[model samples]
Target: MTFKELKHFLGEINVKVDDLYAEKLFNECDTSHSKTLEGSEIEEFYKRLTYRNEIEVIYSKYASSKGKMSVEDLGNFLRMEQREDVGLNEAVALIQKYELDEAAKEKKLMSRDGFLMYLQSSDGLVLNPTHTLVYQDMSQPLNHYFISSSHNTYLMEDQLKGPSSTEAYVRALTKGCRCVELDCWDGPNGDPVIYHGYTLTSKILFKDVIRTVKEYAFKNSEYPVVLSLETHCSMDQQKVMAHHMKTILGSMLLTAPLGGKMPTHFPSPEQLKGKILVKGKKLQSREHSMTSPESLQGEEEESVSEEDEAADLPEEKGMPKKSKLKLARELSDLVVFCKSVHFPGFETARETQAFYEMSSFGESKAFKLAQESANRFVIHNTRQLSRTYPRGTRTDSSNYNPVDLWNAGCQIVALNFQTSDKSMDLNQGKFQQNGFSGYILKPRFMRDGQTQFNPTSIMQGEWLTPKKLHVMIISGQQLPKVNKNKNNSIVDPLVRIEISGVPRDVCSAETEHIEDNGFNPSWNKNFQFDICVPELALVRFVVEDHDTASRNDFVAQYTLPFMSLQNGYRHVPLLTKEGNPIASSSIFVHIMVVDQ
Candidate 1:
């Protein structure tokens, strides 16, 4: 094949080869001295280009002189390195399942290629397979779990000029997001619309969003979906909003108390499965009937929290004086469990707050609260739910670090899922714990109402075993080009390893850059980290181009919980900036964790 064909073939495999790697492969494959690859020569070039000698080292450790691993050898390797105590029968099954050579399978032996294939299979992945399902105790109170949530679920981009669509709801729900925010306002002709209240973002119809939410509510998770409504509508439109939800969601809507009365504790995700819950203000419990229009016609919502006031905009804060809006009787009746309420001081909350009532906090306020009264905040979360969202100043839809809030036991740390960063990466890694039901049970100390665990306490490593993590950056295979427009631009690739968790454990280290080898760049550098909190830690591996003239550009990244990492040779599948998996790009690494 010609050079152009070779480039196209690389594209097919999701490998972006620069002039340096391409030139070397072309020269090596031009055995006929024709300066181009023929039929068999093209195939030969591919085999040599993708082959990594690292696999041979691993295979040699367990294989015989004939480059084959017998059933006994495979079983021993699985039992010792992979930490699986499988018998010889299971080893033979794996050989028959992954080995392409029929003769090797009949002999109950795995070839070198088959060994590598088994290593790349799902069984060989770093994350435990049981974690990919709902494997946690789902019967606990809702406040006992960290829930996946999305803020500004309608905006696909910045709050100022982004387009709002029902597709955003679909995206968030499909990603196992249990709670979604909807900013509702009065639209033309007695209809309600959803968008950023005072921004240039285009509007999506409220009914369309409700329909979309109903369709995808249980698509990814069986847990409840909370519609956090920021209501700014007339009484008539409020009733219209209620009508739309009732008609579209039908019985899936949680319209009444689950068993005729609210529990002292919030309902569990298991109890609320296949249900859609509305989270909004309800009229004060009255001597008069609650369903009567007279009780609700002029009844105003509770004062707008600081986070929801008009001042809570990227460009506009402390500029508006509005506080309350009228609540319709029909709309007020829909709020069953998650009653939106103002948060007074912790003293007042612990003394008077109901289990069904919840509060929302801006990022700054939540972080400050967690800093000043972390133990109290954690104690509060044990009984009632609290949500933390990005501050108003984030005009670009950036995310704040969620680990601090999580450490304080905040249940719903809402983030812009569209803005992929270290924060969102940690969010994804955390939820992978409970089978992606969007609910991960908090640690026992964080769950106990009378707990003595102070997350902000200076006494580090007291309640848990401190661990030392040793990571060896082996190499990268077929990393994508940083600058796609420059076809011939050769990249100097490097790896940055990050540990994200509590304040004391958050740090990063990077490897030296390879001069110009996006393909098969080897580092063989090891990094050591002292982890203070192993349960909450997430390990992120980022690959980037080392650009001296300007800021380094991103190449790919893989993030997972530190506990999920396998200790032996493993391939970390690389993902794009938006957190989508790239086809064939990956980084190779070996991980070892031990008690410090």
Candidate 2:
């Protein structure tokens, strides 16, 4: 083929074939030096183009020099490199699983192509199969687990003008979110409705939201779902809301604590599977003793959590000190295991906090507590659940960094799921483990009150086993075009990796961009990170398109817990900005975790 034709052909296919690649192919394949020659040259060009030299080196090293990986060779590689303890039977089974050649399978050998296929398969993905399964101890109390939670679950867009629909609840549920927020207000015709109250956002009926929740609650995960209600309805309307939940949810709704009495510890996710728990203001006899109608109004103001109090308060504009609406007896009765209560100081909470009662904090307050009393916050969480949510000032419905709150052992670090960003990525990554059950057993230090674990003290004492993380970005395959509208605009793709955790462990680094190459870019770049507390650290791999004149545009990313990552040669799936995996798009990588 002529050079002009070759360049056009390269343009059609999504490969990073620049001038260097074109000239080398033309000079070597054009054996006759004819400008317009064709023959085995076409075959020669394609062969050299798709070949991966990095993989070839490993295959050559362990394939008995016979161009095939025998069971023993595969076993040795897994043991030494992948750190997997495999036996003869296991290696044979893997060969059968990955080997496409029938003859090679019968002889218990994996061809080079088969090896590459295996490396690209799910087994080769960075997430370990064990983590994808329900592998953790699930019998611990609910407070001992990190619950996958969402804030403003009904909003499909921005906080002020976004439309609120039941579909939002369905989406969050399907993604294994265990906790969802519902802002209920009085609606027309005595029916209650849900929306961002006092905002321009649209609203949906309360009954419809409950029905949708009932149907999709256990579809993705059988674990319990917590409905965090910020109710503003009058007593009569609140009774109607409770009736709807009772009739629609049936036995799935937990109306009373298990065993019909309060216990020192809450039920485990395993114990409450398929149940929906109501988290709202519950009336205390002391607060409700005043029979007068005027006194009843004060009960709601006192019992509501601090985060809920600021829900409708406009920033700087200030809301009027209206009479606090009373909580209905029926709706309050439905709040079984998760009764929302106002947060007192850390000292007060440690002394008077009940296991069944929980408190929600605005991001600023939660972070302040985490900073001033790291060990105290950890101890408080060991006995009672704490939820940290976005501040009211996030008019755009943005998310706060959850890793910092999570480090303090807050079980429910709620984020706006509709706003996909670094926060949601971290949330998804943390909950993606333990079979995506929406619950993860907390580390022993975080769950044990007597352990004296402090989030900020990891750098001082030898409490945590720090490790050296070595990541080698081998190459990228079929990275999507950032500007999809520009058919001829090829991306100069680069990989940016970040480690987020406590103050000291947070850092990031990037690779040099591959010019005009969104497809088949070989970086072979390596980065090292010293993770002091791997338990709390999150590793994020972000791919971006380089633009010298402007800031780099985001391409794709994947984030996961540092502890959940599998070592050795693995392929990382590239996810879009919305967290959906791009088809046939992945970056090949080599990872090693060494003890410090």
Check candidate 1 and list the clashing pairs. none
Which candidate leads the pack in lDDT? 2
CA shift at 376, candidate 1, in angstroms? 0.8
lDDT of 1 by residue, 1-596 (tens): 77887877665444566768787888888899887798889889978877879888878888863778999889888877666768999998999989989888888889988987887776666666667888888999889999999999998988778988898888888878999999998999889999987778999899999999988899888899999988988788999999999999999999876786555678888999999999888767421232343764555454333335344654547434555677777888899888888888888998988788899988989999999889899999998899889987797999999989999999989999878787887787778666778998887778888886666663743456698998899988888887766654567899999998777888999999997678778999999999877877889899989988999988888888777777767788888887778876788787778887
Clash pairs (backbone) in predicted model 2: none
Residue-level lDDT of model 2, residues 177-254, one tens digit each, is: 999998988999999999887678999999999999999999989999999998878878999999999999999999
- Separate clash counts for every candidate: 0, 0
Of candidate 1, the 10-residue stretch with the lowest lDDT total is 285-294
